[model samples]
Every structure is written in C-alpha cells, then in structure tokens.
Target: MIPELDGATWHKSTYSGNSGGCVERGILPTGRQAVRDTKDRERGALLFGPSAWQAFVNAVRDGEFGG
Candidate 1:
C-alpha cells in the first residue's frame, strides 16, 4: 500500500522516553527523511538526504553524540 504523504506517516522513536522532549521521523516522497519536533507539528520538519540520514543514524549507533 502506498504510504500517506501527510503526517500519518510520521513516527516516534522507539527509544523515546516519557519525557515531553521528543521528535518524530517520516520518509518523504522524495526519498529524504524528515524530522520534526513532537511538541510543535506546525513548525515543520528538517529534511535530510538519504546519505546524510544514514550517517546520522550511524553516528547515533556509534555513540558519537554523548547521551
């Protein structure tokens, strides 16, 4: 089934805690990744190219950004 182009496709991180601070991710029709703050949906999302998104994910997995 074709995914919805709207906000319906956005999803929260499985690792997100109960804390109010969180973000959602979505895959755009352009194959780019979109990230937006959960607290403010109208604020829009930050789009990332596939490679950039992969690099960011890899960095996170590698613990490049200290928790």
Candidate 2:
C-alpha cells in the first residue's frame, strides 16, 4: 500500500545543478521512497518499496542510464 505524504520531508539532489526541472524524493513512514517532480508537486508522487527503490538508486550510482 502507498503511504501518506502529508508531512513527509522531501528534498532534491544537490547535484541537480540549478535546473528547475529536477525531482524530489521523500521517505514515507512505511520506509518506502516517494518521488515527484519538483515543479509539479501538486500531481503527487510515485511510491516505491524499499528494495525497488534501492535497486533504482544503485543503478543510478552505477550510471546505468548513461546520464
């Protein structure tokens, strides 16, 4: 089930440069991660289970998407 984001702490990457098109990520109470567009927060977010989120993060760190 998706967790509520009412009081979640969302933050964007420092490495996101000065672009206004970056996204934000927040940790839900259930330990899942929620991601949303920084510029369109009103649209809500995509919730990922802990393991799926970890795998995605690892892939990014490994440059799997080639930037």
lDDT of 2 by residue, 8-51 (tens): 78899666777576989997777888998888878889888988
Estimate the TM-score of every prediction: 0.78, 0.81
Residues 1-67 of candidate 1: C-alpha lDDT, one tens digit per residue: 2233463468897777898879889887778888878888777777789999999889989999998
TM-score of 2: 0.81
- Residue 46 lDDT (model 2): 88
- What overall lDDT, based on C-alpha atoms, would model 2 receive against the true structure? 0.83
In model 1, the worst 10-residue window by lDDT is: 1-10
Which residues of candidate 1, in runs, are more than 4 Å off? 1-8
